[model samples]
Target chain A: MDDLSTVWLILAAAAATYLTRIGGYALITRMRTMPPRLEQALNAVPAAVLTTLWAPAFFNSGWDVRLALIVAALVSLRYPGLIMLAAGWAAAMAARHLFGL
Target chain B: MNRRDIIDGLKGGAVIALSTTPFAVLFGAVAVDNGLSIVEAGLMSATIYAGASQLVGIELFGQQVAPWLIVLSIFAVNFRHVLYSAAIARHIRGYSFWQKAVAFFFLIDPQFAESIRRAETGKPVSFAWYMAFGLIIYVSWLLFSVLGAWFGSMLGDPKVWAIDVLLPIYFLGLVIGFRRKPGFYPVVAASMVGSMAGFHLVGSPWHVSIGAICGVAVAALLPLPQKPDQSAEVTH
Candidate 1:
């Protein structure tokens, strides 16, 4: 794509994303109450999204990312802090380098 | 707001803001890897402020796909932010226009969660302090994204030294914290399984949306004991 096209594309994507953000707040501000169902649904959104997002990273190439995710999961379960984050990252990186994942 | 309230808000905002940096760093690296100019990536982080959208945009961009399709994908990926904004709207309704605008920009998942948490605890906070929380997070994201882009340029690839572990660690920690009720487990289980299934079956982005919706639906539908309200409170 040409420069103009790319820029336009980026602009369009940005606009669409921005509208989504704005619309939610605007609607809520107008409505004065969040529906129970939406609240219930929102509660699960991040976990589902985050998990799906991580799957490819975990399984990408072979199973190194998956193993790393498992290690991270364990570390997070126990520590649940920055150190755990480092542990998960370290384990993943080590495995990736060692196994060429 | 009083000084104490402002201070508390700042504290709340700072803690939440701190969490956004790592996410920005990842987005920064991804943006570069996807062939975006540093300026473009920085703007996306600074202005858009939605991580999932930015990430999806980069992925689509990397594929050299059409811009409209990328935009649509990002829209789909970030649809959840609407729910977030809706949840916070009541609290910010009385703020000045500028304050509302600024908070609108910074209101992402963590800040929204923190604000709702505060509201539920009966500590109704001012929009100004909430803006403080939002701004601190927004600025941190911008700085970290810039840094990440620069760092990514220098480092060649981001898939090094286990950095990929950040996502799971951060998310799982959040899940543990959020799932305080006994009834939350089924929802958590559903969501986790749903996400895995979405990835193997559906595909990117959609997997997230579908999985999350399914998990929450299952959780909401499942019968569970309801505790009597301890604190008399309202969300807005």
Candidate 2:
């Protein structure tokens, strides 16, 4: 946790991130083609990843978080852009005030 | 560049900005909670610009885990980006070196997703458009970090639990859009169930990655419908 160690940690982390992204580019460049199966997999990745990310938050949160998610989810179906902001902002304020979570 | 291309890039850039902001806020909060200074958090966000990896790194740092271990963990967690970058190669191969460099900056999940969606639909994928998208996301992520670091300090302990639901709702909306038909329902449900079960057993960060894998695997294995009889007579 000293200056040198911290610097090293940041550099390593950054390098790792860059390499992951670069690897994808490298693969595509080498292949020069995307098969249908791979295309389907790529299409599915975002939703699958996002869901995995979201589920833990829902279960980890207390009651207010659950409610906010439900409200946002319901309203987002109708208006994705506007409702997410409102829902997130409301959830933060409510969590701060109500149960003070 | 032409007017239409420039306009399209700008629009894509603006959307990227919106997507990056919340994540920046989340990152800032994580950094502070883990005992990093506001300046340090901002620097990390500005320098790295990778959200999930940053979050994982900070969490590991807080645990006093080995730095190399942290790096490796983040590398594994972000392995999926390899696939994402591969998907985006066609759009970037035509760009000059500088354009490719610039494109790398905005290559996070949301921008990549948007870019690929356009590609799948046969839209003209321009370097200018990709650069615009990356630049917008990059700037927004930086600003949001500063805001979140300041707010995280001012707000002190954000003890509200109910409000945590916003993200889930965001994800749920995505799930609804992805649902194609009865064919999709069982697979998606199975994935969700499997992931939830994983979350209950394991924990954060890891749960998300594991759950996503579970969901995708289930969806992939689900049997597709068989073709109807070719010789069947048509009924009026």
Candidate 3:
């Protein structure tokens, strides 16, 4: 595609993405209040979305990645911050080097 | 816009920014590697400001996928933002139309997480704080993206340094932060299974939405043992 076409495509994608970000607020603001069940569901969203984002990659990758994720998960449970993330990365790199993955 | 609010907002943003910086750099390098111009990569990061979707877009662009398909795929990948908007709307109800517009444009996952956590804890959700969070992330992301594009080759392979694993690990930490909440495990389980299934059955990006929906469904059906106290922190 031409430069102009690529720019337009990026613009279109950005527009669509912006719409998703704003659309829910626009819709929800008109409603008086959210239902309790819906609220519960909404509350659960972060965990669910994060898991969904991570799980497929976790399961489909090689054992090197799996070991890395396992270390990350265990560290995250205890540390739950940037420190945990560093630990996970360190573990993955260590595994890759040691096992020649 | 008070001094304390500014300090707090910047503090919050700085914490997230530290975590996100490596990924943002990686994104720029990867985008260039995938044949995008530095300007194009920078523009996408500025406009889309979504790491996952932007990565997907670059991959699709490399494959010469149709423009509309790329847009549609990004929309699907980012559909979770709709839920984020809904969750945050209640807190920002008093903001004017334009203010809300600007806020929504910057509503990436980290900002959403931080903002929602604050609101649930009964902290005042000011426009300034929200904007600070967004602006800091936006500026840093753009800066790193450009740096990555220009010096990406010199940085060498991200995987060699294990930078590729950081995102999943960061996300895992975020998920773990919420583990104490009621019905959390079930929701997480549903999402994991649903996304894995979606990956095999449906394909790239759709799994995210599918998994989120599955999680929401399970959480909605399950009975809460106790009403969640808004002021209570989910123990880290």
* Candidate number with greatest lDDT: 3
lDDT at residue B126 of model 1 (Cα atoms): 83
Worst 10 residues of 1 chain B by lDDT: B227-236
Off by over 4 Å in 2: A32-35, A88-101, B29-33, B90-93, B96-98, B150-152, B161-177, B180-187, B200-202, B222-236
- How would the docking of model 2 be graded? acceptable
What are the lDDT figures for the candidates, one per model?
0.67, 0.66, 0.85
Candidate 3 chain B, poorest ten consecutive residues by summed lDDT: B227-236
Candidate 1 lDDT by residue in tens digits, A1-101: 55566677777776776676677667655544445545555555445444445545555534666665567677766674565667766767777887776
Better of 2 and 3 by lDDT: 3
Q: Which candidate wins on DockQ? A: 3
First chain TM-score for all predictions:
0.72, 0.80, 0.92
Interface Cα RMSD, each model? 3.6, 8.5, 4.9
Rate residue B42 of model 3 by lDDT.
Answer: 95
Instruction: List, residue by residue over B1-236, the lDDT tens digit for candidate 1.
Output: 46667788778767656655777888887787777777888888866778767887888878867666777788877776676666566666567777766666666767776776777688865876676667777888888888888777565555664555566556665655565644467776676677667777877777667666666677557553364223222333
User: Each prediction's TM-score against the native?
Assistant: 0.81, 0.80, 0.94
User: How displaced is residue A73 in candidate 3, in Å?
Assistant: 2.3
